[model samples]
Target: MKKLKIGIIGCGSIAKHRHMPEYHASSGAVIAAVCDINEERANVFAGLYGAEVYTDYRELLANKDIDAVSVCTPNYLHAPISAAALNAGKHVLCEKPMATSMEEAKDMIEAASKNGKKLMIAHNQRFVPSHKKAKELIAEGEAGKIYSFRTVFGHGGPEGWSADGKESWFFKKNQAFIGAMGDLGVHKTDLLRYLLGEEFTEVGAFVETSAKIDADVDDTAVCVLKTESGVIGTLAASWSYVSKEDNSTIIYGEKAILRLEDDPVHSLIVQYANDDTVKYELGGIQTNEEGGQKNSGVIDHFLESILNEQEPAIPGSEGMKSLQVILAALEASETKQIVRIN
Candidate 1:
């Protein structure tokens, strides 16, 4: 079997910690090229992988030997870069919140369709062991009609995790677009949609830049979401979590209450109304913290999809659905009204 040649387009924290490492570990893929505006950073990764280095993404996209590319660039560049790569006949694995706007997301999807190449959004929450098990239990009717949920993903701002530290583009509105809502909220929205197999139809939110005094983007967001099936829930994303990162979800159902990533030892716990308890000691979700370096399973999945000529698990359309919810939430926050999704 021919190994897929991958070109990484960003040398940021995500690219360094997730894409590069995972691609290097994969038997079906090899890093054939790397690109970053910062040639020094790109060179570092290039040397590690023995891949070509380019300051311009277009030049990397022009490489005929590259089968696919991972768009790990800032949020603002996702759509254009992915579109360009797709048009260049390379499959794309883009980071989530796939685009800054619905129009951009639509354009990305159209590019993938027009090029006949797979366009996958790196929404890796679905691949977490605990999350996957939770989805299975919910699908098996063990939860028995989820009534409400509260999912939160909070960390101490991207300044510490980003490659450029305090000078990272994550703090700029023009670069990151919507801050925590895009950085963390979209992941939960995607997870909710995947776990419950339902679409969020309405959203009400409060998005603010309560912390990070120098930042232009929002640092905190809280949203109330209504699914098409009428399941209501709250979602919170924040860069203001000072003490420790909190990535947890609690789902209340008729038969049981499901707690995810709430305990240090157990990744998931289900407590039934009948006084029975089930705990899953599934491994931790990947994080930026030390020793939290679990494989995200995204690169492997993308390679498999391309090799098998099948649609990706999280296609551009699915990414748009999740992005639509976040975009609607942003509007709701600004207008102080519940925005309905079309």
Candidate 2:
């Protein structure tokens, strides 16, 4: 079996815990090389994955053997790195919040088009079996006409999840450009959009830096979205949850109400219009820092898109759509008004 020659652009926890392990576990890929600005860390990751290492991503892209790369860097670098790789003739798997701006996101899509290579975002929630089930039920009309939803992804903050803790690049506006909205909020943004198969048409948001004492970025974000189908919902993404919850989503419709979460048991539940309740205490598709689950199932599906020439479950355009929703929410939060998504 031929394996895709893959490189990873960042050696951070997402790489160490998600991408590298998934690539190693997949029969479709091989870790051909890894690049990080920190050479020591890059080399360490490369050694563990049996790949070469480079400090400069430019040098890594120069490799002829590498056919694809996962852009696991900070938000600002997503476009440049992914574009460079695509132009250099490699498929790209970018992490979420596609870019800081829609322009950047379009550039990624265009580059992939210009090169005829695939570009996908790692919105792993799509692969969670519970999520998949929810999508199925919603699509099948078992949930009836969806009316509303509330989704949240919160944790104690970047101090625990990032490479530099509170000092992590996530809080810096230049590197991350936004705070909880970008880091934590964007995932649910993508999930809600995907599960419903609808675009968020308007947004109203409130964002705060209520915790993380000295951080310049927001530690919590709450946004309300109006979907094209007349669905109204709230999405909250935060880093100040006091470890109170993992990521979860609830949807209410004419026929039933649905809930899904990442937990040891009771990962998903539903109560029908007739008050028939069912619970699915299931496992996640992939593992996280807490060893809960992974987004790698999302990663593997993207790899199949590459290897088989099928469409990515979540492509660059879909990622851009998700980002646009979040960006509008950010703007709404700043202005204290509803912002239209055009």
Candidate 3:
């Protein structure tokens, strides 16, 4: 099989940790080009992969040999870059919050549709071992008729994980847009939708900037979301966990309560109504901590979809659906009213 030539835009932390390494390791794909506003960073990655380097993403996109690209830029650039790559006759694997606005997301989807190319969002939570196992358990009736859930994804902040500590685009409203809500909230939103097989119908939230006072974006958010099936849940995303990270989700069901990523030894645990408990040591969820570079299975999945001409697991449409929930949460916080997802 001929390897797909992949160009990487924005050679930052995500591109370094997830996209570049995974693509470089894959036999089905090759990192043929690298782009970043910083020429030095682009040169470093390009040298490692023995690929072309471009300081401007547009010039990289213009390359005819590149078959696809991973848009690893800030949240605001996701849509425009992905759309441009799609229109350039290249498939796109964009980092999530896919876009900062619904209109932008729609445009990206439209571009992919018009260009007959794939557009996959890198919502790595869906690829987590515990999340995958929980989805299977719920589908198999282990967690019967789930009624509610409380999912949280909180960390100290992006200062350490970002390439530019304390000065990354993550703190800028123009670049990051919604901060933790967009960065961390959207992951859980997409994960819940994937696990429940339903879209969120309503949202009430309190999105604020209680931490990182100097930043112009929200550092904390707590949303009450109601699914189409009338199941309700609380979703919280925060960058104020000054000590440790809390990436956990607990689902309450009729037959049992399923806990995911809440325990150190066990990744998942099901406590049945009959007082019986079952634990599964699936694996640890990915984090920004040291030694957290687990294979996300996202780049491989993207390559498989393009190579086999199959629909991507999380297409632009799917990403838009998840983005809608976060958008509604933002609206709810602004208006102080429960916003309905249409």
Candidate 4:
């Protein structure tokens, strides 16, 4: 099969650390072009990868040789760039918090459907080894029927991950839409939904801009979420975890409690009501602080989906569903009431 030529838009930290490197390392794909508003950053990645560079993403999208594009830009640009790429006869791998609004997300899904192009959201948490294992265990009834869960994704701040530090688009309300809620919360939303095999039906949240100075968006958010099957849980996303990060989840079940990424030594642990404990050292969960030692399976899956003409695991519709949870949480925070997911 011919290698899928990939164009990377927005040469920021995620592009540099995750998308570009992973695509370059994948034998099924090739780095065909890179684009960023910062011409120097684009040139640097292009030089390292030996690909063409562009300051404007539209120009990169116009390149007919590029079979796919990674939309690694700010949250606000995700929908527009991904829709444009799909319409331009290119498959899209868009970064998460799919879009700022449901309207935009719907438009992206519509564009991908109309263009008959695969649109995969880069919710890399689903590709984590420990997460995959947990999902399997749950499916196998290792934890019995899940009753509740508390999942959190928190870190010092996007300052550590963004190329521009504190002044990155992450802190700007217009660019980021919602700070940690969109940045970290949506990841957990996707993961929890994947693990439980259910969709969120309602949300109640307290979103605040308490930590980062002068930030217009919320830096901390605690949401109460209810799944379609009546499972209740808390989802917390924050940039205020200064000393250390907590990317962990504890799922309560009828037979056992499954702990994921809660221990330094064990990536997953199961404690049963019979006083038995089983620990599994699958692999460390990827984090903004420690990153990942290996390339995330996202690029490989995306390439395989395109090459085989199959729907991606986290397609545009799946992304939209996850985005709705966060959007409902945001609305709940603003309205001071539980918001129903539609």
Candidate 5:
């Protein structure tokens, strides 16, 4: 089979560490072109990935050989870039949050359907092995009926990746729209949605800025979610965690309590009502290209979807639903009342 030629727009941290590396690892895909506002950065990324570089994504999109494009730009550009890629007859794999607004997300979905191209979102959390198995167990009634749960995806500010720490565009309302909510918050939102298999009905949130004083965007976000299945839960995320990682989720069911914690070992710990605890140690969660906390299984599976012409695990519409939960959380924080997720 001929390699699927891929173009990467916005050669930033995510494009560098996740998408580009995953594409490099895929025998069925090749990095054919790259685009970024910074010509030097684009050139460096293209050279490193063995691909051609373009300052404007428009030029790169003109290449007929490029079968797909990954939009790794800021939240604001996600919709427009993905739309353009789809219009140009290329499959789109957009980085998460889908878009800055619900309307933008709808537009992205419309573009995908109209162009008849595959549209997938990079929600890597849903691809975690432990998380997947946990969902499976819950669905199979192995954990009984879920009572409550909590999910958190937090980390220090993107100072390591951003040009400016708190002063970065990510901290700005215009560049990012929402701070930690859009960054880390969206991941947990997607994770919760994936785990529970239900849409959020309403959200009550207390979102604020704590660590990054210069940031006007909220660095800490704590949200209360009411699911359509009548499940009440909390979705907490922040860019202010002090080194200690806390990407965890716990679901308390009638028969057992399921626990999934991040890194150093991603496992499924089930504690029964009688206090008998069981452990399922999962060692092979990520693909070969993954490093550190970066899981490449999602990207590899996406490539496989393109190759097989199958629906991606996380489609554009499903990603929009996750964004809706985040939007509701933002609204809840702004209004200081429960906002319905619709």
Candidate 6:
């Protein structure tokens, strides 16, 4: 099989920490190019991966040698760049909250369909060991009928994770768009939908920027979501958890409650109503802390889908469904009404 020549757009922290490194490690892919508005950062990745560097993503996309591209740019650029890459005849693995708006998300899907290219959203939470196990147990009815769930994804802030540190685009409303909701909440929305195999139909939210000083976007958000099957849940995404990160989820069911990524040793725990308990030592959730693990199986899956001529597990339509929930949450928070997904 010919190696997939991958170009990375946005040589930011996520690209540096996740996409670039994971692609470099993949046996079926090669880092053909790297692009960032900041030439220095792009050059750094280019030097590390022995790939060409570009300041403009369009230039990188125009490279006929690049078979695929990863859009690790900000939330606002995800749609445009991925759409452009797809139109340029390259498969796209885009970082999530697929786009800033529903329209842009749809455009991305159309672009992929029109160009006959694959478009996959990098919602890596689905690949996490604990998350994958939770999905399996729920699908097999081991969780017995899921009643409700509460999932949270929080940490210090993007200031600690972005390449520009405190000056990252994540704090800017125009760039990051919806703050923690886009950065963290969307992950939960996608995960819960994947786990339960249902799409969210309605949302109510409380979004605020109380934690991050001078930040234009929300730092904390709590959204109440209801799936088509009547499974209700609360999703909390925050950039204010200064003490420690809380990337955990609890699914309450008729038979048991499954807690994922909530413990230090066991990554998943199931406690039955009859007092029987099961512990699963899958592995810790991925984080950007000092020694945190970063690989999330996104690049591998993208390359495999291309190599096998199969659609990605999380295609643009699936990503749009998740993004719609978040967009509805934002609308609900703004209009003070329960927003329904169409």
RMSD of each: 0.8, 1.6, 0.8, 1.0, 2.3, 1.0
Candidate 4 per-residue C-alpha lDDT over 38-135 given as tens digits, one digit per residue, 9 for 90 to 100: 99999999999999989998898899999999999999999999999999999999999889998999999999999999999999889888889889
Clashes of each: 0, 5, 0, 0, 0, 0
**lDDT (CA) per prediction:** 0.94, 0.86, 0.94, 0.92, 0.84, 0.92
- Report the poorest 10 consecutive residues by lDDT, candidate 2: 284-293
Expressed as tens digits, the lDDT of each residue in 1-342 for candidate 5 is 889999999887778778888888889999999998989889898788789989888999899989999998878889999998999999999998889887899888899899888899998888777898999988999778788898887777776666344456787788788888888889888888898888889899999999888887888999998888888888888888877556778888999889887435547788899889888888644421233345558678888888898989898889999898888888888888889765
Residue ranges of candidate 3 with Cα displaced over 4 Å = none
- Work out the TM-score per prediction: 0.99, 0.96, 0.99, 0.98, 0.95, 0.98
Candidate 6 off by > 4 Å: 290-292
Better of 5 and 6 by TM-score: 6
Compose the digit string of candidate 6's lDDT tens values, residues 24-114: 8889999999998889888888899999989988888889999999999988899999999999999999999999988999999999999
Better of 2 and 4 by lDDT: 4
Give the range where candidate 6 is weakest over 10 consecutive residues by summed lDDT.
Answer: 286-295
Q: Which pairs clash inside model 5?
A: none
RMSD from true fold, candidate 6: 1.0
Over 4 Å off in model 2, which ranges? 262-264, 285-289, 292-295
Give residue 5's lDDT in candidate 3 (0 to 100).
96
Q: Candidate 3: minimum summed lDDT over ten consecutive residues — where?
A: 286-295
What's model 3's lDDT at 225?
A: 96
Candidate 3 lDDT over residue span 17-53, tens digit each? 8898899889999999999999999999989999999
| lDDT measured at residue 262 in model 3 versus the true structure, 0 to 100 | 97
